[model samples]
Target: MKSNLVCRNRETVRINEYIHMPKQLSPAQVEQFWNDGFLFPVDAFDGVQAKKYRNLLEEAERDHPGEIHAEHRNNAHYILKFLDEIAHHPVILDVMEDLLGPDVLLTGTVLFIKEPQTPAFVSWHQDSTYTGIEPKEGITVWVALSEASSESGCMQMIPESHHQGILEHHDRFGENNILTRGQTIEGIEKERAVDVTLKPGQISLHHVRTVHSSTPNRSDDRRIGLALQSFIAASVKQTLGEDYALSVRGQDPFQHFLRARRPQSDYEPEGIAFREAANQRLSDILYHGSELKRDY
Candidate 1:
Protein backbone atom coordinates (compact mmCIF):
# COMPACT_ATOMS: atom_id res chain seq x y z
CA MET A 1 0.00 0.00 0.00
CA LYS A 2 3.06 2.26 0.09
CA SER A 3 4.84 3.86 -2.88
CA ASN A 4 7.55 6.48 -3.47
CA LEU A 5 7.81 9.23 -6.06
CA VAL A 6 10.95 10.85 -7.49
CA CYS A 7 10.69 14.46 -8.69
CA ARG A 8 12.85 15.37 -11.66
CA ASN A 9 12.68 19.17 -11.48
CA ARG A 10 13.43 19.46 -7.77
CA GLU A 11 14.25 17.49 -4.63
CA THR A 12 11.65 14.75 -4.19
CA VAL A 13 8.87 15.68 -1.81
CA ARG A 14 8.43 12.47 0.12
CA ILE A 15 4.73 12.00 0.78
CA ASN A 16 3.98 9.78 3.76
CA GLU A 17 3.65 6.26 2.39
CA TYR A 18 0.66 5.50 4.61
CA ILE A 19 -1.24 8.66 3.80
CA HIS A 20 -3.73 8.38 0.95
CA MET A 21 -3.39 11.10 -1.65
CA PRO A 22 -5.63 11.34 -4.65
CA LYS A 23 -4.03 12.23 -8.01
CA GLN A 24 -7.23 12.29 -9.99
CA LEU A 25 -8.21 15.92 -9.49
CA SER A 26 -5.69 18.67 -9.06
CA PRO A 27 -6.63 21.65 -6.88
CA ALA A 28 -7.09 23.73 -10.03
CA GLN A 29 -9.32 21.09 -11.57
CA VAL A 30 -11.47 20.96 -8.45
CA GLU A 31 -11.80 24.73 -8.50
CA GLN A 32 -12.66 24.65 -12.19
CA PHE A 33 -15.44 22.15 -11.55
CA TRP A 34 -16.96 24.35 -8.83
CA ASN A 35 -16.52 27.53 -10.85
CA ASP A 36 -17.26 26.27 -14.34
CA GLY A 37 -19.66 23.44 -13.42
CA PHE A 38 -17.88 20.78 -15.49
CA LEU A 39 -14.63 19.14 -16.64
CA PHE A 40 -13.98 17.28 -19.84
CA PRO A 41 -11.63 14.74 -21.47
CA VAL A 42 -10.41 13.14 -18.27
CA ASP A 43 -8.46 10.01 -19.15
CA ALA A 44 -10.34 7.13 -17.54
CA PHE A 45 -9.71 4.09 -19.77
CA ASP A 46 -7.42 3.05 -22.59
CA GLY A 47 -8.66 2.96 -26.18
CA VAL A 48 -8.52 -0.80 -26.40
CA GLN A 49 -10.48 -1.14 -23.16
CA ALA A 50 -12.99 1.43 -24.28
CA LYS A 51 -13.62 -0.49 -27.48
CA LYS A 52 -14.26 -3.65 -25.49
CA TYR A 53 -16.72 -1.79 -23.28
CA ARG A 54 -18.51 -0.42 -26.30
CA ASN A 55 -18.74 -3.93 -27.71
CA LEU A 56 -20.68 -4.98 -24.65
CA LEU A 57 -23.42 -2.50 -25.49
CA GLU A 58 -23.52 -3.66 -29.06
CA GLU A 59 -23.71 -7.25 -27.91
CA ALA A 60 -26.55 -6.40 -25.57
CA GLU A 61 -28.46 -4.77 -28.37
CA ARG A 62 -27.95 -7.85 -30.52
CA ASP A 63 -29.17 -10.10 -27.71
CA HIS A 64 -32.06 -7.90 -26.59
CA PRO A 65 -33.23 -5.99 -29.59
CA GLY A 66 -35.36 -2.89 -29.07
CA GLU A 67 -34.66 -2.87 -25.32
CA ILE A 68 -32.09 -0.06 -25.11
CA HIS A 69 -34.68 2.57 -25.91
CA ALA A 70 -34.43 5.85 -24.05
CA GLU A 71 -37.21 5.04 -21.63
CA HIS A 72 -35.57 1.75 -20.67
CA ARG A 73 -31.92 2.77 -20.71
CA ASN A 74 -31.70 3.62 -17.05
CA ASN A 75 -29.97 1.37 -14.49
CA ALA A 76 -28.00 -0.63 -17.05
CA HIS A 77 -25.31 -1.47 -14.50
CA TYR A 78 -27.78 -3.56 -12.55
CA ILE A 79 -28.15 -6.00 -15.45
CA LEU A 80 -24.81 -5.77 -17.27
CA LYS A 81 -21.43 -6.87 -15.94
CA PHE A 82 -19.46 -4.46 -18.11
CA LEU A 83 -21.53 -1.56 -16.95
CA ASP A 84 -21.35 -2.67 -13.33
CA GLU A 85 -17.57 -2.84 -13.56
CA ILE A 86 -17.36 0.69 -14.97
CA ALA A 87 -19.82 1.95 -12.41
CA HIS A 88 -17.44 0.83 -9.68
CA HIS A 89 -14.28 1.67 -11.59
CA PRO A 90 -11.51 3.01 -9.37
CA VAL A 91 -10.49 5.93 -11.57
CA ILE A 92 -14.02 7.25 -11.77
CA LEU A 93 -14.67 6.58 -8.09
CA ASP A 94 -11.47 8.26 -6.97
CA VAL A 95 -12.27 11.47 -8.82
CA MET A 96 -15.80 11.33 -7.50
CA GLU A 97 -14.53 10.84 -3.97
CA ASP A 98 -12.21 13.81 -4.44
CA LEU A 99 -15.16 16.02 -5.28
CA LEU A 100 -17.98 14.43 -3.27
CA GLY A 101 -15.89 13.10 -0.39
CA PRO A 102 -16.11 9.52 0.87
CA ASP A 103 -19.29 7.42 1.20
CA VAL A 104 -20.02 7.43 -2.52
CA LEU A 105 -23.11 5.79 -3.99
CA LEU A 106 -23.49 4.78 -7.59
CA THR A 107 -27.06 5.94 -7.94
CA GLY A 108 -27.73 5.28 -11.61
CA THR A 109 -26.25 4.55 -15.06
CA VAL A 110 -27.71 5.00 -18.53
CA LEU A 111 -26.78 4.93 -22.18
CA PHE A 112 -27.34 7.96 -24.38
CA ILE A 113 -26.83 6.55 -27.82
CA LYS A 114 -27.70 8.46 -30.97
CA GLU A 115 -27.79 6.66 -34.25
CA PRO A 116 -26.31 8.24 -37.36
CA GLN A 117 -28.52 10.86 -38.99
CA THR A 118 -31.10 10.46 -36.26
CA PRO A 119 -33.36 13.12 -34.74
CA ALA A 120 -32.27 12.26 -31.21
CA PHE A 121 -31.32 15.19 -28.97
CA VAL A 122 -31.17 15.99 -25.27
CA SER A 123 -32.94 19.18 -24.28
CA TRP A 124 -31.04 21.74 -22.25
CA HIS A 125 -31.89 21.14 -18.62
CA GLN A 126 -30.32 20.62 -15.24
CA ASP A 127 -30.19 17.00 -14.04
CA SER A 128 -31.47 18.13 -10.62
CA THR A 129 -34.75 19.08 -12.25
CA TYR A 130 -35.72 15.42 -12.18
CA THR A 131 -33.30 13.61 -9.84
CA GLY A 132 -35.16 14.99 -6.75
CA ILE A 133 -32.19 14.14 -4.58
CA GLU A 134 -31.92 16.68 -1.80
CA PRO A 135 -28.77 18.58 -0.81
CA LYS A 136 -27.91 18.34 -4.52
CA GLU A 137 -24.54 16.70 -3.93
CA GLY A 138 -23.82 14.54 -6.93
CA ILE A 139 -22.32 14.46 -10.42
CA THR A 140 -22.84 12.81 -13.80
CA VAL A 141 -19.76 11.33 -15.43
CA TRP A 142 -20.46 11.05 -19.13
CA VAL A 143 -18.05 8.45 -20.50
CA ALA A 144 -17.68 8.37 -24.25
CA LEU A 145 -17.82 4.87 -25.71
CA SER A 146 -17.15 6.41 -29.13
CA GLU A 147 -15.77 9.71 -30.34
CA ALA A 148 -17.95 12.51 -28.93
CA SER A 149 -17.34 15.22 -31.44
CA SER A 150 -19.40 18.30 -32.22
CA GLU A 151 -20.63 16.69 -35.40
CA SER A 152 -21.55 13.61 -33.39
CA GLY A 153 -23.58 15.62 -30.90
CA CYS A 154 -21.32 15.97 -27.92
CA MET A 155 -22.85 17.53 -24.82
CA GLN A 156 -22.67 21.32 -24.39
CA MET A 157 -22.97 23.25 -21.16
CA ILE A 158 -23.09 26.84 -19.94
CA PRO A 159 -20.19 27.71 -17.67
CA GLU A 160 -20.78 28.59 -14.00
CA SER A 161 -24.45 27.76 -14.38
CA HIS A 162 -24.44 25.48 -11.35
CA HIS A 163 -23.85 28.39 -9.02
CA GLN A 164 -27.23 29.79 -10.01
CA GLY A 165 -28.89 26.80 -8.39
CA ILE A 166 -31.74 24.92 -10.05
CA LEU A 167 -33.44 26.85 -12.80
CA GLU A 168 -37.06 26.66 -13.93
CA HIS A 169 -37.75 24.09 -16.62
CA HIS A 170 -40.87 23.26 -18.65
CA ASP A 171 -41.82 19.98 -20.28
CA ARG A 172 -41.77 20.17 -24.06
CA PHE A 173 -41.55 16.45 -24.86
CA GLY A 174 -40.50 17.32 -28.34
CA GLU A 175 -40.47 14.66 -31.03
CA ASN A 176 -36.69 14.38 -31.18
CA ASN A 177 -35.83 15.14 -27.57
CA ILE A 178 -34.73 12.14 -25.46
CA LEU A 179 -35.60 13.63 -22.08
CA THR A 180 -38.54 12.06 -20.23
CA ARG A 181 -40.53 15.28 -20.46
CA GLY A 182 -38.56 17.03 -23.20
CA GLN A 183 -37.66 19.49 -20.47
CA THR A 184 -35.54 22.53 -21.38
CA ILE A 185 -34.32 25.81 -19.96
CA GLU A 186 -35.36 28.90 -21.84
CA GLY A 187 -33.22 31.67 -23.39
CA ILE A 188 -29.76 30.13 -23.41
CA GLU A 189 -27.19 31.99 -25.50
CA LYS A 190 -25.83 29.33 -27.82
CA GLU A 191 -22.66 31.35 -28.15
CA ARG A 192 -21.92 31.00 -24.45
CA ALA A 193 -22.04 27.25 -24.33
CA VAL A 194 -18.94 25.07 -24.57
CA ASP A 195 -18.85 21.71 -26.31
CA VAL A 196 -17.73 18.83 -24.09
CA THR A 197 -15.94 16.89 -26.78
CA LEU A 198 -14.19 13.62 -25.93
CA LYS A 199 -12.43 10.73 -27.61
CA PRO A 200 -13.28 7.15 -26.81
CA GLY A 201 -12.41 6.19 -23.20
CA GLN A 202 -12.40 9.78 -22.00
CA ILE A 203 -15.08 11.39 -19.81
CA SER A 204 -16.75 14.65 -18.92
CA LEU A 205 -17.86 15.25 -15.35
CA HIS A 206 -20.63 17.74 -14.81
CA HIS A 207 -22.35 18.89 -11.69
CA VAL A 208 -25.99 17.96 -11.13
CA ARG A 209 -27.07 21.56 -11.59
CA THR A 210 -25.08 22.23 -14.72
CA VAL A 211 -27.24 23.27 -17.67
CA HIS A 212 -26.44 20.88 -20.50
CA SER A 213 -27.88 19.48 -23.72
CA SER A 214 -26.90 17.77 -26.99
CA THR A 215 -27.81 18.05 -30.64
CA PRO A 216 -28.85 15.40 -33.09
CA ASN A 217 -26.11 13.17 -34.47
CA ARG A 218 -25.09 14.11 -38.00
CA SER A 219 -22.19 11.74 -38.32
CA ASP A 220 -21.98 8.46 -40.22
CA ASP A 221 -21.66 6.33 -37.08
CA ARG A 222 -23.42 5.98 -33.77
CA ARG A 223 -22.56 8.34 -30.95
CA ILE A 224 -22.50 6.42 -27.69
CA GLY A 225 -21.92 7.57 -24.14
CA LEU A 226 -22.68 6.32 -20.64
CA ALA A 227 -23.96 8.62 -17.95
CA LEU A 228 -22.86 7.37 -14.55
CA GLN A 229 -24.58 9.15 -11.67
CA SER A 230 -22.95 9.13 -8.26
CA PHE A 231 -23.48 11.01 -5.03
CA ILE A 232 -22.28 11.26 -1.48
CA ALA A 233 -24.15 8.51 0.32
CA ALA A 234 -24.65 10.51 3.51
CA SER A 235 -26.02 13.46 1.56
CA VAL A 236 -28.92 11.49 0.09
CA LYS A 237 -32.18 12.09 1.92
CA GLN A 238 -35.67 10.54 2.18
CA THR A 239 -37.25 13.50 0.43
CA LEU A 240 -37.95 11.46 -2.70
CA GLY A 241 -39.07 8.38 -0.78
CA GLU A 242 -37.06 5.18 -0.41
CA ASP A 243 -34.92 4.44 -3.47
CA TYR A 244 -32.23 2.03 -4.60
CA ALA A 245 -28.52 2.94 -4.58
CA LEU A 246 -25.27 1.03 -4.96
CA SER A 247 -22.50 1.76 -2.51
CA VAL A 248 -19.33 1.82 -4.59
CA ARG A 249 -16.99 3.02 -1.86
CA GLY A 250 -16.71 3.69 1.86
CA GLN A 251 -19.55 2.82 4.27
CA ASP A 252 -23.22 3.60 4.00
CA PRO A 253 -24.27 4.02 7.64
CA PHE A 254 -27.44 6.03 7.02
CA GLN A 255 -28.94 3.62 4.48
CA HIS A 256 -30.86 6.47 2.90
CA PHE A 257 -31.55 4.37 -0.19
CA LEU A 258 -32.05 0.67 -0.67
CA ARG A 259 -28.82 -1.19 -1.39
CA ALA A 260 -28.63 -2.90 -4.78
CA ARG A 261 -27.16 -6.40 -5.20
CA ARG A 262 -24.63 -6.98 -7.99
CA PRO A 263 -25.86 -9.07 -10.89
CA GLN A 264 -24.58 -12.64 -11.03
CA SER A 265 -24.55 -12.44 -14.83
CA ASP A 266 -25.50 -10.06 -17.59
CA TYR A 267 -29.25 -9.64 -17.84
CA GLU A 268 -29.93 -12.43 -15.40
CA PRO A 269 -33.67 -12.81 -14.98
CA GLU A 270 -33.66 -11.76 -11.35
CA GLY A 271 -31.36 -8.80 -11.94
CA ILE A 272 -33.47 -7.52 -14.81
CA ALA A 273 -36.59 -7.74 -12.72
CA PHE A 274 -34.89 -5.95 -9.86
CA ARG A 275 -33.62 -3.22 -12.18
CA GLU A 276 -37.08 -2.77 -13.68
CA ALA A 277 -38.64 -2.35 -10.25
CA ALA A 278 -35.91 0.05 -9.17
CA ASN A 279 -36.20 2.07 -12.37
CA GLN A 280 -39.92 2.38 -11.75
CA ARG A 281 -39.20 3.74 -8.28
CA LEU A 282 -36.77 6.23 -9.79
CA SER A 283 -39.24 7.27 -12.45
CA ASP A 284 -41.76 7.98 -9.73
CA ILE A 285 -39.27 10.26 -8.05
CA LEU A 286 -38.27 12.03 -11.28
CA TYR A 287 -41.74 12.36 -12.76
CA HIS A 288 -43.80 12.35 -9.59
CA GLY A 289 -47.55 13.09 -9.72
CA SER A 290 -47.42 13.31 -13.51
CA GLU A 291 -49.91 11.20 -15.41
CA LEU A 292 -47.17 10.05 -17.77
CA LYS A 293 -46.29 6.39 -17.26
CA ARG A 294 -42.91 5.96 -15.57
CA ASP A 295 -40.16 5.85 -18.22
CA TYR A 296 -36.40 6.66 -18.31
Candidate 2:
Protein backbone atom coordinates (compact mmCIF):
# COMPACT_ATOMS: atom_id res chain seq x y z
CA MET A 1 0.00 0.00 0.00
CA LYS A 2 1.14 3.59 -0.63
CA SER A 3 1.74 6.15 2.10
CA ASN A 4 2.27 9.93 1.78
CA LEU A 5 5.52 10.01 -0.21
CA VAL A 6 6.77 6.80 -1.92
CA CYS A 7 5.81 3.20 -1.35
CA ARG A 8 7.73 1.11 1.16
CA ASN A 9 9.26 -0.95 -1.59
CA ARG A 10 12.53 -2.86 -1.54
CA GLU A 11 14.39 0.14 -2.94
CA THR A 12 13.10 3.08 -0.90
CA VAL A 13 11.13 3.91 2.22
CA ARG A 14 8.37 6.44 2.70
CA ILE A 15 9.39 10.07 3.20
CA ASN A 16 6.88 12.48 4.64
CA GLU A 17 6.64 16.20 3.88
CA TYR A 18 7.00 17.29 7.46
CA ILE A 19 10.52 15.98 7.83
CA HIS A 20 13.32 18.53 7.75
CA MET A 21 15.07 18.42 4.35
CA PRO A 22 16.81 20.63 1.83
CA LYS A 23 14.72 23.17 -0.07
CA GLN A 24 15.93 22.70 -3.63
CA LEU A 25 12.55 21.29 -4.56
CA SER A 26 9.29 22.73 -3.33
CA PRO A 27 6.97 20.73 -1.07
CA ALA A 28 4.59 19.94 -3.92
CA GLN A 29 7.43 18.85 -6.22
CA VAL A 30 8.75 16.48 -3.59
CA GLU A 31 5.26 15.13 -3.09
CA GLN A 32 4.98 14.47 -6.81
CA PHE A 33 8.34 12.71 -6.80
CA TRP A 34 7.34 10.40 -3.94
CA ASN A 35 3.95 9.71 -5.41
CA ASP A 36 5.18 9.37 -9.00
CA GLY A 37 8.69 8.00 -8.45
CA PHE A 38 10.14 10.88 -10.51
CA LEU A 39 10.46 14.63 -10.80
CA PHE A 40 11.62 16.86 -13.70
CA PRO A 41 12.47 20.32 -15.07
CA VAL A 42 14.87 20.89 -12.21
CA ASP A 43 16.95 23.89 -13.31
CA ALA A 44 20.60 23.03 -12.76
CA PHE A 45 22.50 24.62 -15.67
CA ASP A 46 22.15 27.82 -17.56
CA GLY A 47 21.72 27.73 -21.33
CA VAL A 48 25.28 28.86 -21.99
CA GLN A 49 26.69 26.31 -19.58
CA ALA A 50 24.65 23.51 -21.04
CA LYS A 51 25.71 24.42 -24.54
CA LYS A 52 29.30 24.64 -23.46
CA TYR A 53 29.19 21.19 -21.95
CA ARG A 54 27.54 19.84 -25.05
CA ASN A 55 30.23 21.43 -27.17
CA LEU A 56 32.88 19.91 -25.00
CA LEU A 57 31.37 16.45 -25.38
CA GLU A 58 31.13 16.81 -29.14
CA GLU A 59 34.68 18.05 -29.35
CA ALA A 60 35.93 15.03 -27.46
CA GLU A 61 33.72 12.73 -29.46
CA ARG A 62 35.25 14.09 -32.62
CA ASP A 63 38.76 13.94 -31.21
CA HIS A 64 38.69 10.52 -29.58
CA PRO A 65 35.41 8.86 -30.39
CA GLY A 66 36.46 5.39 -29.33
CA GLU A 67 36.96 6.33 -25.70
CA ILE A 68 33.33 7.44 -25.31
CA HIS A 69 31.77 4.36 -26.84
CA ALA A 70 30.97 0.88 -25.50
CA GLU A 71 31.74 0.26 -21.81
CA HIS A 72 33.78 3.43 -21.67
CA ARG A 73 30.55 5.40 -21.54
CA ASN A 74 29.76 3.85 -18.18
CA ASN A 75 32.22 6.04 -16.28
CA ALA A 76 33.56 8.79 -18.54
CA HIS A 77 33.80 10.98 -15.45
CA TYR A 78 37.00 9.16 -14.56
CA ILE A 79 38.74 10.63 -17.63
CA LEU A 80 36.61 13.54 -18.76
CA LYS A 81 36.83 16.74 -16.75
CA PHE A 82 33.42 17.87 -17.97
CA LEU A 83 31.81 14.60 -16.99
CA ASP A 84 33.62 14.67 -13.66
CA GLU A 85 32.27 18.13 -12.93
CA ILE A 86 28.84 17.11 -14.11
CA ALA A 87 28.78 14.11 -11.82
CA HIS A 88 29.79 16.24 -8.87
CA HIS A 89 27.58 19.18 -9.75
CA PRO A 90 26.41 20.82 -6.54
CA VAL A 91 22.84 21.51 -7.64
CA ILE A 92 22.20 17.88 -8.51
CA LEU A 93 23.91 16.75 -5.29
CA ASP A 94 21.81 19.14 -3.26
CA VAL A 95 18.65 17.55 -4.55
CA MET A 96 20.05 14.10 -3.85
CA GLU A 97 21.17 15.07 -0.36
CA ASP A 98 17.80 16.62 0.41
CA LEU A 99 15.88 13.49 -0.50
CA LEU A 100 18.23 10.66 0.51
CA GLY A 101 19.84 12.45 3.49
CA PRO A 102 23.13 14.30 3.86
CA ASP A 103 25.58 11.58 2.80
CA VAL A 104 25.58 10.89 -0.97
CA LEU A 105 27.80 8.60 -2.99
CA LEU A 106 27.80 8.75 -6.77
CA THR A 107 28.08 5.20 -7.96
CA GLY A 108 28.39 5.77 -11.70
CA THR A 109 27.45 7.79 -14.77
CA VAL A 110 26.06 6.85 -18.20
CA LEU A 111 26.38 9.11 -21.22
CA PHE A 112 23.28 8.67 -23.39
CA ILE A 113 23.37 9.82 -26.97
CA LYS A 114 20.68 9.00 -29.47
CA GLU A 115 21.86 9.91 -32.90
CA PRO A 116 19.32 11.62 -35.09
CA GLN A 117 17.19 9.16 -37.06
CA THR A 118 18.93 6.23 -35.41
CA PRO A 119 17.10 3.12 -34.24
CA ALA A 120 18.71 3.21 -30.78
CA PHE A 121 16.13 2.87 -28.01
CA VAL A 122 16.05 1.96 -24.36
CA SER A 123 13.68 -0.77 -23.25
CA TRP A 124 11.48 -0.46 -20.19
CA HIS A 125 13.44 -1.38 -17.08
CA GLN A 126 14.15 -0.45 -13.49
CA ASP A 127 17.55 1.04 -12.65
CA SER A 128 18.06 -0.99 -9.47
CA THR A 129 17.28 -4.42 -10.92
CA TYR A 130 20.77 -5.11 -12.27
CA THR A 131 22.67 -2.66 -10.05
CA GLY A 132 23.20 -5.04 -7.09
CA ILE A 133 22.89 -2.12 -4.72
CA GLU A 134 20.71 -2.94 -1.74
CA PRO A 135 18.17 -0.88 0.15
CA LYS A 136 17.56 0.57 -3.33
CA GLU A 137 17.55 3.98 -1.77
CA GLY A 138 18.96 6.05 -4.62
CA ILE A 139 18.01 8.55 -7.32
CA THR A 140 19.15 8.95 -10.95
CA VAL A 141 19.69 12.51 -11.98
CA TRP A 142 19.32 12.73 -15.79
CA VAL A 143 20.72 16.03 -16.96
CA ALA A 144 19.91 17.06 -20.48
CA LEU A 145 22.71 18.36 -22.68
CA SER A 146 20.28 19.03 -25.51
CA GLU A 147 16.56 19.50 -25.85
CA ALA A 148 14.75 16.47 -24.47
CA SER A 149 11.39 16.63 -26.15
CA SER A 150 9.01 13.94 -27.33
CA GLU A 151 10.49 14.34 -30.81
CA SER A 152 13.92 13.78 -29.28
CA GLY A 153 12.81 10.63 -27.49
CA CYS A 154 12.89 11.90 -23.94
CA MET A 155 12.56 9.44 -21.06
CA GLN A 156 9.13 7.97 -20.39
CA MET A 157 8.36 6.64 -16.94
CA ILE A 158 5.44 4.98 -15.21
CA PRO A 159 4.19 6.65 -12.08
CA GLU A 160 4.39 4.61 -8.86
CA SER A 161 5.84 1.58 -10.65
CA HIS A 162 8.56 1.38 -8.01
CA HIS A 163 5.86 0.48 -5.51
CA GLN A 164 5.78 -2.96 -7.07
CA GLY A 165 9.38 -3.33 -5.89
CA ILE A 166 11.93 -5.22 -7.97
CA LEU A 167 10.04 -6.81 -10.82
CA GLU A 168 11.29 -9.58 -13.09
CA HIS A 169 13.33 -8.65 -16.20
CA HIS A 170 14.28 -10.57 -19.32
CA ASP A 171 17.37 -9.91 -21.38
CA ARG A 172 16.38 -9.66 -25.03
CA PHE A 173 19.42 -7.62 -26.12
CA GLY A 174 17.55 -6.62 -29.22
CA GLU A 175 19.32 -4.88 -32.09
CA ASN A 176 19.08 -1.08 -31.69
CA ASN A 177 18.41 -1.55 -27.97
CA ILE A 178 20.70 0.79 -26.04
CA LEU A 179 20.74 -1.20 -22.80
CA THR A 180 23.59 -3.64 -22.22
CA ARG A 181 21.36 -6.67 -21.92
CA GLY A 182 18.35 -5.01 -23.46
CA GLN A 183 16.82 -5.81 -20.06
CA THR A 184 13.12 -5.15 -20.06
CA ILE A 185 9.89 -5.48 -18.08
CA GLU A 186 6.96 -6.58 -20.15
CA GLY A 187 3.24 -5.71 -20.16
CA ILE A 188 3.38 -1.99 -19.45
CA GLU A 189 0.43 0.14 -20.56
CA LYS A 190 1.76 2.72 -22.99
CA GLU A 191 -0.98 5.22 -22.20
CA ARG A 192 0.08 5.50 -18.59
CA ALA A 193 3.63 6.51 -19.39
CA VAL A 194 4.71 10.08 -18.77
CA ASP A 195 7.23 11.80 -21.06
CA VAL A 196 9.95 13.55 -19.06
CA THR A 197 10.86 16.40 -21.37
CA LEU A 198 13.55 18.90 -20.49
CA LYS A 199 15.48 21.87 -21.85
CA PRO A 200 19.23 21.75 -22.34
CA GLY A 201 19.90 23.10 -18.89
CA GLN A 202 17.25 21.13 -17.05
CA ILE A 203 17.41 17.81 -15.22
CA SER A 204 15.09 15.06 -13.95
CA LEU A 205 15.31 12.91 -10.82
CA HIS A 206 13.84 9.44 -10.70
CA HIS A 207 13.76 6.71 -8.11
CA VAL A 208 16.03 3.76 -8.78
CA ARG A 209 13.17 1.30 -8.99
CA THR A 210 11.02 3.41 -11.27
CA VAL A 211 10.16 1.82 -14.63
CA HIS A 212 11.44 3.99 -17.50
CA SER A 213 12.56 3.86 -21.13
CA SER A 214 13.08 5.99 -24.20
CA THR A 215 12.28 5.65 -27.90
CA PRO A 216 14.63 6.30 -30.80
CA ASN A 217 15.56 9.88 -31.43
CA ARG A 218 13.35 11.31 -34.13
CA SER A 219 14.64 14.83 -33.94
CA ASP A 220 17.11 16.26 -36.44
CA ASP A 221 19.86 16.82 -33.91
CA ARG A 222 21.59 14.28 -31.70
CA ARG A 223 19.77 13.78 -28.43
CA ILE A 224 22.24 13.98 -25.57
CA GLY A 225 21.73 13.33 -21.88
CA LEU A 226 23.99 12.37 -19.00
CA ALA A 227 22.62 10.03 -16.38
CA LEU A 228 24.22 10.13 -13.01
CA GLN A 229 23.46 6.40 -12.75
CA SER A 230 22.89 6.53 -9.02
CA PHE A 231 23.43 8.67 -5.98
CA ILE A 232 22.98 6.67 -2.82
CA ALA A 233 23.44 7.28 0.85
CA ALA A 234 26.88 6.49 2.24
CA SER A 235 25.31 3.61 4.18
CA VAL A 236 24.43 1.72 1.00
CA LYS A 237 26.67 -1.20 -0.06
CA GLN A 238 27.25 -3.40 -3.05
CA THR A 239 26.21 -7.02 -2.85
CA LEU A 240 28.10 -8.19 -5.95
CA GLY A 241 31.79 -7.54 -5.29
CA GLU A 242 34.45 -4.86 -4.92
CA ASP A 243 32.91 -1.46 -5.73
CA TYR A 244 34.03 2.13 -6.05
CA ALA A 245 32.20 5.43 -5.73
CA LEU A 246 32.73 9.16 -5.31
CA SER A 247 31.83 10.77 -2.03
CA VAL A 248 29.78 13.70 -3.26
CA ARG A 249 28.48 15.05 0.01
CA GLY A 250 28.63 14.87 3.79
CA GLN A 251 30.56 12.14 5.67
CA ASP A 252 30.91 8.56 4.45
CA PRO A 253 31.90 6.60 7.53
CA PHE A 254 30.53 3.47 5.85
CA GLN A 255 33.32 3.20 3.26
CA HIS A 256 31.34 0.52 1.49
CA PHE A 257 33.11 1.21 -1.83
CA LEU A 258 36.64 2.26 -2.69
CA ARG A 259 37.27 5.97 -3.14
CA ALA A 260 36.75 7.30 -6.71
CA ARG A 261 38.46 10.52 -7.72
CA ARG A 262 38.01 13.24 -10.34
CA PRO A 263 39.58 13.25 -13.79
CA GLN A 264 42.37 15.76 -14.28
CA SER A 265 41.41 16.22 -17.93
CA ASP A 266 39.75 14.48 -20.82
CA TYR A 267 41.37 11.11 -21.47
CA GLU A 268 44.13 11.72 -18.97
CA PRO A 269 46.45 8.70 -18.69
CA GLU A 270 46.05 8.20 -14.95
CA GLY A 271 42.32 8.80 -15.11
CA ILE A 272 41.82 6.32 -17.94
CA ALA A 273 43.66 3.63 -15.99
CA PHE A 274 41.43 4.24 -12.99
CA ARG A 275 38.32 4.24 -15.18
CA GLU A 276 39.23 0.89 -16.75
CA ALA A 277 39.64 -0.77 -13.38
CA ALA A 278 36.47 0.80 -12.06
CA ASN A 279 34.53 -0.25 -15.14
CA GLN A 280 35.80 -3.83 -14.89
CA ARG A 281 34.51 -4.01 -11.31
CA LEU A 282 31.23 -2.32 -12.19
CA SER A 283 30.82 -4.68 -15.14
CA ASP A 284 31.04 -7.67 -12.87
CA ILE A 285 28.34 -6.22 -10.64
CA LEU A 286 25.94 -5.22 -13.44
CA TYR A 287 26.26 -8.30 -15.58
CA HIS A 288 26.48 -11.03 -12.97
CA GLY A 289 25.11 -14.47 -13.94
CA SER A 290 24.54 -13.38 -17.52
CA GLU A 291 26.15 -15.42 -20.27
CA LEU A 292 25.95 -12.65 -22.81
CA LYS A 293 28.49 -10.10 -21.64
CA ARG A 294 28.45 -6.99 -23.85
CA ASP A 295 31.47 -4.75 -24.34
CA TYR A 296 29.48 -1.72 -23.20
Model 1 poorest ten-residue lDDT run: 1-10
Return the top candidate by lDDT. 2
- TM-score for all predictions? 0.90, 0.94
Candidate 2: where is the Cα deviation over 4 Å? 1-21
Segments of candidate 1 deviating more than 4 angstroms: 1-21
Best by TM-score: 2
User: Which tens-of-lDDT digit does each residue in 1-296 have in candidate 2?
Assistant: 34422444323422433456455877677667777889998999899999999999988888887788644578988899888888878888878866777788999999999989888999999999988897776889999999999999999999988766788899998988989899999999889999999999899999998999999999999999999989998988898887889999998999998999788667778988898899899889888999998887
Clashing pairs in 1: none
State the displacement of the C-alpha of residue 207, model 2, in Å, after optimal TM-score superposition.
Answer: 0.4
True-structure lDDT of candidate 2: 0.86
